[model samples]
Target: MNDDELVNRLKEIIIEEEIDIIIVGEPVTLAGYASEQTQKSREFAQLLEKYLTVPVKLFDERLTSRRADAATLGATMPTRNRDELAAMFLLQDYLDKQKSNNF
Candidate 1:
């Protein structure tokens, strides 16, 4: 879907789900340069932040899909590197970092 569609859907979900924070997955190339996907994700986050009251944070999403795929391997119904699964891994990592930094 396009960025506009994604932003609109996220707005709807934020309201419907009463979301407090938004964690955007930033696509970082292994070489450390920004790829087209990174640019698109940044644009999406920028658009989303305009309409959101809560904080919108970008998390590094390098290899998250691969990690998700590896984690679900040997399972009967793996998520097949689904975007949601990747996002979950990103968010979990973000949360873990936050927890660690809290100390």
Candidate 2:
């Protein structure tokens, strides 16, 4: 979704669900530099922050889709949304990082 569509969709979700912080996936180049897509994500996050009351953070999304594909390679029931799976893993990684930072 474009930033506008995403913000609109998130507005609906925010009204319906209790949310604290937002984590955005920043897909960097393999060399750890920001790519065009990463810049786009950063800009979207910036725009999102302007509309949101909660904090928004960028998390590295290196190989998340690949990992998601690997994880669900053998699934036969029905194809799950790979994007959602990647988001789940991304959130888990962010949460884990936050937890460790407390130590």
Candidate 3:
């Protein structure tokens, strides 16, 4: 989806689910490397903040997408990587980090 569409969709989900926070998945490259696409995640966070009432945060999404891709490859059925699962991993990773820092 495009930027506007993504923002709209996130707003809808936030409203529908009464979500308190939005954590965006930002996958780095192998061995914890950031790439040019990382800028897009920042832009997305900015758009989300502008459009939504709730807070949006970016979390290190390293290996989450890769794990999902591996799972799809291992599955018996012909499945593909899912963005939602990646998002879930992103949120969980953020939560884990917060707990680690006592934040």
Candidate 4:
């Protein structure tokens, strides 16, 4: 999805879920370096910070998509994309941090 679509969708989610924090999946390469998409994601996170009252952060998304794909690849494959898996991983990381911090 484009930035405009993402921003709009995020707004809806925030309103619906009463979300306190927006954790974005950081796009990193296999070598643990930032990918080209990192800049775009960071920009998106910045934009989200401006529009939403909640805090926004970029959580490392390394191997999450791969792990998700691996988990499903063994079974009947669902037609899921990398982005969805990556988003799940990012959300999990945020949730874990929240749990630790008692947020």
Candidate 5:
């Protein structure tokens, strides 16, 4: 879906799920350098902030895909499933960091 469609869908989900915030994955190189995808992610986050009621935060997603692949090494799954797993890793990391900061 396009950005407009994505924004509309996210808005619906935020209300339907009563989500307080949105965590977006920020893809960067292993060396922690910003790449083209990182720029795209930032732009998308800006778009989300402009259109959505919930706050949008970007979290480092480096190595998430690799971790997902390792976690599913022996399993056979579609690419989309792997992508979803990577997203889970990203969100979990974000939450973990938030929890640590609260202490």
Candidate 6:
């Protein structure tokens, strides 16, 4: 979907789920350098911030995919499931830092 469609869908989900904040995963290199994908994620987060009423924050998502892969070792899983697992790891990392007052 395009940006407009994504924003509209996010709006619906926000209202439906009573979402107060949005945590966007910022994919960066292991060395903490920005890549093309990092720039894209930053731009997307900016777009969400501009269009959504809720606050949008970007959190480091380094190693999330690898962690997800390790978690599902020797198992056959769909790409969508692996992506969802990576998202879960990203969110959990964000929440952990937030809980510790480190973020």
Q: Pick the candidate with the highest lDDT.
A: 6
Pairs with backbone N, CA or C atoms under 3 Å apart (clashes), candidate 2: none
**Candidate 3: C-alpha lDDT:** 0.76
For candidate 2, lDDT tens digit of each residue in 12-101?
A: 887789888899999998789988999999998999899888889999999887778888884643335888888899999998998999
Clashes of 1: 0
- lDDT of each model, Cα atoms only? 0.84, 0.87, 0.76, 0.78, 0.93, 0.94
Winner of 3 and 4 under lDDT: 4
Q: Give the per-residue Cα lDDT of candidate 2 at 12.
A: 81
Off by over 4 Å in 3: 70-73, 76-81
Count clashes in each candidate, considering only residues at least 3 apart in sequence or on different chains.
0, 0, 0, 0, 0, 0
Query: Global CA lDDT of candidate 2, please?
Result: 0.87
TM-score for each model: 0.80, 0.84, 0.74, 0.73, 0.95, 0.94
Arrange candidates by TM-score, descending: 5, 6, 2, 1, 3, 4
lDDT of candidate 4 over 2-57, digit per residue (tens) = 86887788889889988888787887787878767988888878888887778888
Worst 10 residues of 5 by lDDT: 70-79
Question: Of 2 and 3, which scores higher on TM-score?
Answer: 2
The better-scoring model by TM-score among 1 and 4 is 1
Query: Model 6: how far is 58 from its true place, Å?
Result: 0.6
List model 5 lDDT by residue over 1-103, tens digit each.
Answer: 9988988898898889999999999998999999999999999899999999889999999999889999998488898999999999999999999999999
Error of 4 at 49 (Å): 1.1
lDDT of 1: 0.84
Write one digit per residue (lDDT tens) for candidate 3, span 25-82: 7767767777778878877788888888998888888878666667577554433336
